[model samples]
Target chain A: MTALLSLAIDITLLSVILAMLLCMIRLLLGPTAQDRVLALDTLWMCAMLLALALGLRFASIIYFEAAMLIALTGFVSTVALTKFLMRGEVIE
Target chain B: MTPELDTLPVWVSLPVTLLLLLGSAIVLIGALGLVKLPHFFQRIHGPAITITLGTGAILVASMIYFSALQSRLVIHEVLITAFIMLTAPVVAMLIMRTAVYRDLRARERGKTPPAVKDGEASEVYPFSTKKSLSAKK
Candidate 1:
């Protein structure tokens, strides 16, 4: 039973990590600014998913808290980018 | 523990695991689309797919598994889900604005957006403004 559970956890973790790696490729190869920003957005979602997986694997709430923080930071960055794009600057 | 997982039945873990895997796969495919999509406009939609469906799946899995394990109603997963739903669109909006800005500037300069906005001011993303045109010049 323990072995099966571990396998499940490992597979989940591997798949999430693989997704993160693919997003990283877009981050590196993006031919345009929008593409890179889009990739960054995906990257944040991937990281959050990873955190949830960790929480499940360890049976800890701390990972979830960390995930929340990551989500917040990602939000702020995206907003800043949008504002900068619209106004020609992110801040005054 | 969120004060809820203690009573979660063991049976819930299997399906939750499956959902998470499925979500991760979707995210992977979205990234691939981001890489392979031809233009900035098409690329914008790719990650949106991940942010919506992909994140939704993982969040559902979290809610289910945690609720089952902790033996209580865990509602905090909703918070993250809400956060992602709110932010992904905003980020995409910014990227689109940047693309549009580049397009307009390109038309002005008599060159394709690729040549004019490649590292120019008009291409500045709506977020940092600091990383845009002035730096390139």
Candidate 2:
């Protein structure tokens, strides 16, 4: 059972990492500012998932805290970035 | 590393494993769509899969694994899941609106239409013809 669980966790970790890499490629290769912003948003989500998977693997609450933090920060950043893209300034 | 799983029986472990795999696969498919889809609007749909179903699956799996292992409720994962669910669509909407705003501005400036398909072009920019006609004057 431990072996099976470990295998599942490892596969999830690998797949999420691959997804992050793909998001990075889109971020780099995106033709428009909106595309780049979308890629960044997806990138942050991938990071959150990666942190969650790590938390599961280690069976630690610290990783959960980190995942929560990532989620909070990622949402704020994406919102700010999208606002900037929309109005050319974030505060307005 | 293995201590957590040692407590879980095959029944519990099997579902957790399947959930994890299914969630990751959905996330990967979403990311793949983001990369392969041509238009920015089309690409926007990709990550919806991750935000809704993928994140839900993984969070549920985590909740189940920890709750089963510790022999108690471990519902904190719900916070992350709820936060994600609340925020993802907002972000997608904001980014999409920004894209539309930019595209309209570009069209107003008489820039050539992007390589969007004909059917989608009309739907995506309803006033495109009128704008182009006005710009020509």
Candidate 3:
């Protein structure tokens, strides 16, 4: 049972890492600022999920806290980036 | 490195494993779509898949795994799930609106022709007809 659980977590971790790599490619090659921002947002989300998978693997609460922090930061950064893209500045 | 998994029955472990795999696979597919799609608006649809169903699956897996392992309620994952659900669409909307705004401005300056065809323009942009006709004049 433990082996199965470990296998599942490992697979999830690997898949998310691959997803992040794909997002990175888009981030670098994206032709427009909006595409780049979209890639960044996806990258952060992958990071958050990666943190959660690690938490599951290690069976630790600390990773959960880290995941929450990532989520919060990801939202804020996405909002700020989009705002900048929209108005050419973040704040009025 | 072993933890409480040894004690879990097949019923519990099986579902958790399936959920994790399914969720990650969806996320990967979404990311792939984002990279492979031809346009920004089409690409926007990609991550929506991940944020809604992918995140939900993973969070539910985490919640079930922790709750089962600790023999107690572990619902904190819900917080992150809720936050993501509420915020992702807003971010997507902001980015999309910004893209449309930029494209429209470019059209007004005669930098590029209207992106959408006449038949599709009305559905996508209500003012597209007026803008395109005015720009042509």
Clashes of each: 19, 0, 0
Model 1, which residues run further than 4 Å from truth?
A: A1-5, B1-10, B115-137
Across A15-51, the per-residue lDDT of candidate 3 in tens digits comes to: 9999999999999998778888999999999999999
Candidate 3 residue B126 Cα shift, in angstroms, is 8.9
TM-score of chain A of each: 0.87, 0.96, 0.96
DockQ for the candidates, in order: 0.47, 0.77, 0.67
**What TM-scores do the predictions have?**
0.79, 0.92, 0.89
Q: What is model 3's native contact fraction?
A: 0.71
| Inter-residue clash pairs, candidate 2 | none
For candidate 2, what is the interface RMSD?
A: 1.2
Candidate with best lDDT = 2
lDDT per residue for candidate 3 within B1-111, as digits (tens), equals: 555678877777888999998999999999999999776777888889888888888899999888888888999998998899889878888889877877776666765
Pairs of colliding residues, candidate 3: none
What lDDT does the true structure give each of the candidates? 0.72, 0.87, 0.85
Q: Which lDDT tens digits does candidate 1 get at residues B1-137?
A: 23344344457756776776677677777877877766676676777878898888878887887676666798798999887877777677667767777665655566655623444443343333335545646
**lDDT per residue as tens, model 2, B22-113:** 99999999999999987787789999998889989999999998888888999999999889888877888899888877777776677744
User: 1 or 3, which is superior by lDDT?
Assistant: 3
lDDT (C-alpha) at residue B15 in model 2: 96
Please identify model 3 stretches exceeding 4 Å from their true place.
Answer: B113-137
